[model samples]
Target chain A: MNRKEFIDQLKSSLSRLPQAEINEIIRDQEEYIQDAIQAGRSEENVIASLGDPKTIAASLNATTQIEKAVGATSLKQQAGHTFQAVFAMLALAPFNLIFVLGPFLGFAGLVFGGWVASSSIALSVVAVLIAFLFKFAFASAGIFSFLSMLLFLLGALGAATLALIAMYHISHFFLTSTIRYLRWNLKLAGITKN
Target chain B: MNSQFNKGVIEMCVLALVKQRDYYGYELVESISKRIEISEGTIYPILRRLTQEGYFETYLQESTEGPPRKYYRITTHGKKTAEDSVRDWKNFVTSVDSTIHSQEK
Candidate 1:
C-alpha cells in the first residue's frame, strides 16, 4: 500500500490493539520511516521493504513473554518498579548467585591453588618415584596449564553473565506474580484498575 | 492453540513480545495469532490487565483515517516481568527435561 493508504490500513488494523499504544507506535515508526527515506532510499522502496505496515504493526503489538525496551519512569514508578525488581532479584539472590558462579569458580580455584599449594609435596614424592618420567612429560601442564587462563577468563565472563541472567529472571518472576499481587495491593490501597 | 490456552498465555505472550520490541495493539494480536490461536478480542483485556497493573503505559496519536489510536508500551516492571518469566520458563523446561531423562541411572 502507498504511505497514506498504509498508515490508514495500519490504523484500521490497530483498532484491535490498545488505542494509546497504536498511536505511539505509528508516530514513532513514521519518524523512523521518514528518516530512512531521507537517507536516500525511495519512499516506495522503503515502504515495500518494510512490507505491509499492518503486518509489521501486528508483530509489533504481539506481547511475548518478556517485554522489549523499557523507558525510564518517574520517581514514583521508578521507585516502585526498582523496588519490585530489586526485591524480587534479592529474593532469589543467593541461589541465583551460587548456581551461576559457584561451581566454575570452585573447580578452577581448586585446580590452581590446590596445585600450587600441593605442588612441592607432590613433586617431592614424584621425584623419588619417577623423577625422570616427570621431566619427560609436562605433567603439571595437564588440562589447565595451556587453557586455564583462557578458560578462566571465559568462565568468569560466563558466570557474570549467568548472574545477570539469573537476576533478571528472578525479577521477572516477581513482576509476573506481582501483577496479581498489585491487584490486591491496589484494592487494599484504595485504587481501582483504572 | 485453543481459546483456553490462548486465554492463559495471552498476557504472557503479549508482554513477552513487547519486551523484545515495541508493538501496537493490533500488531501484537495479529503477530501472536500466527503462532498461537487466540480470539481477536482476547488481547484487549490482557492489555487492560497489564496497564492496570502498571506493567504497561499508553499514549494516543492522531490518525489520518479516523479517531486517534492509543499505543501501549512496556513499563520497566513489565520488561523485568517478561525477562524473568522467560528465564523461569527455560529453567522449568530444563528441570523437567533433566528429571525425565537424566543419565544418572
Candidate 2:
C-alpha cells in the first residue's frame, strides 16, 4: 500500500476514536512514510515493513480505551469504558480471554453481590416496617410497645443506610483498582504502549 | 523471542535514548530498529504514550529537506524513569542469568 492507502485504512479502522486522536495517529504514519521515502526507501517497502494498518490501529485503540476507562466520571460510564477496553484487549489477543475475563468476572460478581446485599438490607427494613404497621392497625397490639417499634425501625433504617453508603465506597474502590489492574495487565500483555 | 519482552525493553530503550539527546520520530525509530527488529509503526504509539504520560515533551522543528518534524525531549520524570528501568532491567537479567547457569551446572 502507498501512504494514502495506508493512512486511509488506519483512519477507517480507528473510526471509534475522536477526530483529533485519529488525526494525530494518521500524522505519525504520514511522517514515518515521508521520512522513509526521504531516506531512499520505496513507499511499498516502508508500508510493508510497518506491518498491517489494522493491527497498528488495534494496538492504539486498546491503549486509549483503557485510558478512557480510567478517566470515566460516572459508574455507568465507567462500566461502558471498562467493557470497551476489555473487548479491545481481547481483540488484540484471544488468549487473554481466559486470563483476563475469568478474574474480571469473579471480581465483578463480588462487586455486584455487595451492591445487591446493600440494597436488600435497605429494602428489607422498609418491608418490616410496613408489616408491623399493617398488623398494628388490624389486630391487638403485640408484645412490643409502639414507641419501641418506632425506635427499632429508626435503628434498622440507620444501619441499612450505613451499609448502603459503605458498599458505595467499597464498590467504587473495587472499580478504580480493577481498571488500574487491567492497565497493568495490558502493559504485560504488550497490548498497551508501555 | 517474546513480543511482550521486546515491548518492555523498548520502553526502557526509548527512555534511555531520549535522556541522552533529543530525537525526532524517524530518528528514534531508526536507532532502535538498528539494534532490534520491530514493526516501525509500533514506535509511534509508544512515543505518543510516553509523551502523554509526561515523560517526554515534543516540539516541531523545520527541516531543510522537507516539512517540519516533531522532536522529542526527555523530561525530568523521564530521566528518573530511565534510571529506575535500567536498574530493574539489570537486576532482572542478573537473576535470570544466574538461574540459567545453575540449571546447566
Candidate 3:
C-alpha cells in the first residue's frame, strides 16, 4: 500500500479518538512517511516498514485510552475513561469478549448495587427521622415522648453516618479497581510503560 | 526479540538517545530502527506518552527540506530514568546469561 492509503486506513481505524488526538497521531505517521520517501525510499517500502495500519491504530488507541483513564480526575470521569479503555482492549482480540465481558459486567453490577444499597439506607434513615419529628410535634409532651424522640434522633444520625461512610469506602474501592483493571488492560494490549 | 520485551526496551532506547541530543520523530525512528527491528509507527505513541509524563519536552523546528519538525529533548527526569533503566537492563542480562550458561554445563 502507498502512504495515503496507509494513513487513511489508520485514520479510519482510530475514529473513536478525539479529533485533535487523531490528527496528531496521523501527522506523526505522515511525517515519518515523508521523511522516508525524501530519504530515497519508496512509498510502498515505507508503508511496509511501518507494519499494518490496523495493528498500529490498535496500539495507539490502547495507549491513548490508558492515558485518559490515568488522567481522569473525578469518579464519573474515571468510570467513563475506564469503560473506553476496556472496550479498546477487548477490540484488540474478539475472543476476549467471552472471557472479559462476563466478569466486567459482574464487577460493574456489584459497584452499582453497593451504591444503590448505601444511598437507600441513608435515605430511609432521613425519612424515618422526618416522620418521627412530625409525630413528636402532634403528640402530647410527656417524659416518655421526649426520651423516645431523643433515642430516634440518635439512632437515625448514627445509621445515616454509617451508611455514608460505607458509601465512601465502596466508591473508593471501585475507583481503585477501575485503575487496576485499566493497567491490566494496557498490559494485555502490549502497551506497557517499560 | 519478543514484541512484549521490545516494547519496554524501546522506551529506554528513546530516552537514552534523546538524552544524548534532541531528535525529531522521523530522525528518532530512523536511528532506533537502524539497530532494532520495530514498527516505526509505535515510536510516536511512546514519544507522546513520555512527553506527557514530563520526561521529555518538545518543540517545533523548521526544516529546509520540508515543513517544520517536532524535536524531542530529554528532561532531567528522563536522564535519570534512562540511567536507572540501563543499569537494570545490564543486571538483568548478566543474571540471565549466567543462569543459561550454568544450565548448559
Candidate 4:
C-alpha cells in the first residue's frame, strides 16, 4: 500500500481514540513515510518494511489506552479506560485472548459483585425501616418494644452503611490493582516495558 | 530470535541511541534496522510511549529536503533507565552464555 492507503487504514483502525490522538499518530506516520520516500526509498518499499498498518495502529492504541487507564481519576473513567486498554491489548496480540481475558473476566466479575452487594446493603436499610414501621402500625407496640425496634433499626442501618463504605474501598482497590496487573501482564507477554 | 525478545532490545536501542544523540524518526529507524531486522513501524509506538512516559522529549526541526522532521532527545531519567537496562542486559547475556557453553561441554 501507498502512504495514503496506509494512513487511511490506520486511521480507521484507531477510530476509537480521540481525534487529537488520531491526528498526532497520523502525523508521525506521515512524516516517517515522507522521510523514507525523500531518502530514495520507494513508497511501497518503505510501507512494506513498516509492516501492517493495523498492527501499528494496534500498538499505538494499546499504548495510549494503557496510559489513560493508569492516569484515570474517577471510577467511571477508570473503568472505561480499562475496558479500552484491555480491548486494544487483546487486538494487539492473539495470545492475549487466552492470557488476558480469563483473569480479566474473573476479576471484573468480583468487582461487579462487590458493587452490587454494597448497593444492595445500602438499599436494605430502607427495608429494615419499613419492617419496623409495619410492626408498630399493626400491633400495640409498647414503649420497650418501640425502643428496642428503634435501636435495632439504628444498629442495622449503621452496620449496613459501614459495610457499604468498606465494600467501596475493597472494590476500588480491586479496580486499581487489576489495572496494575494488566500492565504487568503486558510486560510478561513481552509486549512492552515495566 | 523471537520478535518479543527483540521488542525489549529495540526499546533499549532506542533509549541508547537517543541518549547518545538526538535522532529524527527515519534516522532512528534506519540506524536500528541496519543492525537488527524489525518492522520499522514498531519503533514509532515505542517512541510515542517513551515520550508519554517522560523519558524522551521531541522537537520539530526544518529539513532542507522536505517538511520539518520530529527529533527525539533523551531525558536524564531516560539516561538512567538506559544505564540500568544495558547493565541488566549484560548480566543476562553473561549468565545465558555460560549456561549454553556449560551445556555444550
lDDT of 4 by residue, A8-61 (tens): 999999998899989888888888999999889998999888888887787788
Q: On residues B7-93, what C-alpha lDDT tens digit does candidate 3 reach at each position?
A: 478888888899999999888988988877777766776788788778999888888888678899999999999899899989999
Q: Which regions of candidate 3 fall more than 4 Å away from where they truly are?
A: A93-102, A141-143, A184-194
RMSD of each: 20.4, 3.6, 3.3, 3.0
Tens-digit per-residue lDDT, A1-194, candidate 1: 57788678777755645688677556655754554455576777655644555434333333211122123233234324433432222222334334524553354454445435444444444444354345436655555554654455455556555554554454444444533343332222211010
Q: What's the lDDT of the predicted structure labeled candidate 3?
A: 0.77
Candidate 4 regions with alpha-carbon error over 4 angstroms: A130-140, A187-194
Candidate 1's iRMSD: 14.6
User: Could you tell me which 10 consecutive residues in candidate 1 chain A have the lowest summed lDDT?
Assistant: A185-194
- Winner on DockQ (2 vs 3): 3
Task: Report the error of model 2 at residue B97, Å.
Answer: 5.0
lDDT of 2: 0.81
Q: Model 4 over residues B1-105: C-alpha lDDT tens digits?
A: 456678578888899999999999999999988877777888898899899888999999998988888999999999999999999999999999999999998
Query: Which order, best to worst by TM-score?
Result: 4, 3, 2, 1
- Rank all candidate structures by their DockQ, best first, as comma-separated numbers: 4, 3, 2, 1
DockQ of every predicted complex = 0.03, 0.39, 0.41, 0.45
TM-score head-to-head 1 vs 4, winner: 4
Colliding residue pairs in candidate 4: none
Pick out the ten consecutive residues of candidate 4 chain A with the lowest summed lDDT. Answer: A185-194
